[model samples]
Target: MIMRRPAVAGQFYPGNENDLRELIKKLAPEHTPSKIPALGVVAPHAGYIYSGRVAAEVYASIEEAPTFVILGPNHYMYGSAVALSTQEWMTPLGNVQVDEDFIDCLPIGIIDKDELAHRSEHSIEVQIPFLQYFFKDFKIVPIALGLQDYDTIKELAGELVKAIEKYDERVVIIASSDFTHYEDVDVAHRKDRALIKTIEQLDVPAFYDELYRINASTCGYGPIGAMMMACRERGAKYGKLLRYATSGDVTGDRQVVGYAGIAVY
Candidate 1:
């Protein structure tokens, strides 16, 4: 059995299991909000210190699902344009199984089941601990995208919907992403908010247009677009931004990466 080990445990999050749990508990908001059966969500993938609270808010707001399809950018530009990993992912929390059946249901050739792409990618890896925290029994389908063109993302979303329909299982798609990168705190918020407004409308094209217009350095545009497309195809009407912050908020750094937690239902 192939095991995908944690690549950024000590760096992006705590290496110790107990510490990871404790940190998540602390990052999670004290007031509980009734969870929504969201179709999809957009969560950030920066170091937990920078974006953990944003991610926690997104996960905490969503209703638990039997399977979660996580789409994240292939930041290293490795492997196939659209790559999927079938290996069980390991975290400090435990091993989380991949939903192989769901992958099999997807139309062939569109996504390469390439483990190389996910071997060291941190975007998808960081979200698992949060899942392990909230749900007792759940599986994940992790897709790393090296390509984010409009046609490609739309096609990918179509196949995703097809797989969901065939499997008939409760599932949610999580697009792991961080917004503006390495910009002044004010600049990051300005650009990210403009791009986010398009996302709130569920207008994928507008999101892309605004992204290119501002030359926003969002690392997961493809993943975010894919999620919006798939969720809309599933009859999701609107998206809500549960939280928005930046690394600057945590460190008071002049340059920061924007993070947002949004839910679609």
Candidate 2:
């Protein structure tokens, strides 16, 4: 099996195993994850120092599961709206096995096995280590979404629901995304709050509507929208915001990328 090694390791997070472990622990510092069932979660995908704490908060709230369906934006990839990979992903912590079997089970017919689409992408890659930190031996099905069209996301959500029923597996869905990018801190908060409000209500239509209404720049919104639909299908009533921050918090810059951690159960 081809190994999907880290492409942004040294730049986005620690390159060494010990250092990576220390950083994760330092960010979490005795954080205890919830045992309650989780249908889906949303976490940021920037560098660890800027977004790790918030990501950890959402991860901490999710109950342990054998498999995770991780959806992330295709920031650099092209050609396919949905790119699915069936390879082991390597991170500083260790190798996270891809759920190849589950990947084959998805009912969506538009997806393609496009490893090249994931080669230079950091969004999904950034979430692997956090999953490794939380669970000892869990597989992940990583999909990079390049489009945020409404009908596409809605159809993908329905397919996911059918796939879950066909497989009869208890899985957790995760969306790796930043709230808003390169906006003034005040404007970023306003845009992100509007987006988060829709998220909390689990209103897929409102979620998609407000995204364009406010001109929000969430890179992985397609995945977030799909996960929200899956959450609602699985009986998730609401989403709780765990944490929200921005690059400005770390760099002291006026222009920042908004980040948030939300859990749906």
Candidate 3:
């Protein structure tokens, strides 16, 4: 079955190729990464007007890649984990092939097949145009994470590492997420900074703990948890919070959604 592109394209991002290219060109970093990372990245998935610059920070860090394993929150559907639509995902840019081999290797009990789960999911879809712009040609294993607990995230992450270990292709792990939704501007910055601090310390557990305690409305908590586990397993030593801001900063609104760009190396 064909997986469709479902997002507010022109509204959220530029629909025209030339316009989109120009936007990406304007946002892309002037300096390229000297060495490519294999481990983890956390990027926002809000509209381009709100999160494009922050998202660019993470995407720009990756010089090139043949494959990426993307973990994103299940926004439109609720479940444990949905390995939905192993078909190519369509975007205005082009089709990004799903890594069927890697999907096949996932532990059977952990993955569920459900296309409806992905139909209106913008979390994963929003990242595609950015990936297409930067990488040009690459395949992705798209995994939609649900409301699973932290321990479950760790277990799944371990399985993910083992599943793709034998592949010769260079793979990047991208966790698509937006931080702290619909708080006042001041509140958003304060909460996002606290979370960023935790990420910088590589304290994933502490990050979750603090988020729960403070009720930081980060939607990608599950994906972040999984990414932290995967990064640890891959021996990632450092994390850098590249950019952090809110929709308020972009739109000059009091009510805002937070966006962050992070790199784990």
Candidate 4:
């Protein structure tokens, strides 16, 4: 079987298993997680020190699931519009089994096996340690999408719903995205709020419209939009913002990247 090792291990997170486990323990919140399970969640994909706390907070709120469908943006744009991986993802913590069953069932237009697209993408990889920290036994379906129009995302969502039904009923959808990249801290906040509002309201179409019209500088808007549709189709009524922050909060930088953890229930 092909093993997909970490591409950003030493850079974005610890490359050693012991160190990774310890860092996650340190960053985790100290409150009991809610019993309410979420259908989907949106988490940031920055380095651990910058966005780990927010990601951990949102993760702490989720209930158990058999599988996780992680959707992320293709920052490098090396593969197909929607790329899937057949290999297992190797993190410092351990190897995460990819839900090959689900990937095989996905329509070709929705997702195709493309290891190159996932090889160097940090967006989806950053969230795996959190999964390792939170659950003992669960598989993942990692999808990387390029800049696709809303119509494309809508079609992908329908395929995703069918894939989920064919794969696992107990699943949690996660979209890895960093909002408002490399803007003034104030400007980043302003732009990210627009995206967050749509996420909290669980407005899929409005999210696409705002991302285009307002030019909300989010890198993974497509992933978020796809998750919104998946959540809606799964019968989620509302979404809530668990936490929000920017890189400026960790580093004293004028130009910052906005980060947030949103829960869709």
Local distance difference test values of all predictions, in order:
0.93, 0.86, 0.79, 0.87
User: Which regions of candidate 3 are displaced past 4 Å?
Assistant: 32-38, 78-80
lDDT digits (tens) for residues 88-192 of candidate 2: 899888888887667767874767778887889999999888888877878998888887688877877787777777765678899889989999999999999
Point out the worst 10-residue segment of candidate 1 by lDDT.
100-109
Steric overlap count per candidate: 0, 0, 0, 0
lDDT of 4 by residue, 1-265 (tens): 6788899998999999999889989888898555458989999999999999999888877887878999999999998878887789999988999876766777766567788899899999999999999889989998899766788778888988887777645888898998998989988888888878988888888888888886778888888888999889989888888889999998999989899899999
* TM-scores for every candidate against the unseen true structure: 0.98, 0.96, 0.92, 0.95
Candidate 2 residues lying further than 4 Å off, grouped into runs, are: 29-33
| Distance from true location, Cα of 26 in model 3, Å | 2.4
TM-score of 1: 0.98
**What's the true lDDT of residue 179 in model 2?**
89
- Higher-scoring candidate on lDDT, 3 or 4: 4
Screening candidate 2 with a backbone cut-off below 3 angstroms (N, C-alpha, C), the clashing residue pairs are none
Give residue 91's error in model 3 in angstroms: 0.6
Candidate 1: tens digits of C-alpha lDDT, residues 1-265: 6799999999999999999999999999888689988999999999999999999999888899999999999999889899999999999999999998887899875889899999889999999999999889999999999999899999999999999999978989999999999999889989999988988889999999998899999999999999999999999998999999999888988899999999998
**Local error of candidate 3 at residue 195 (angstroms):** 1.2
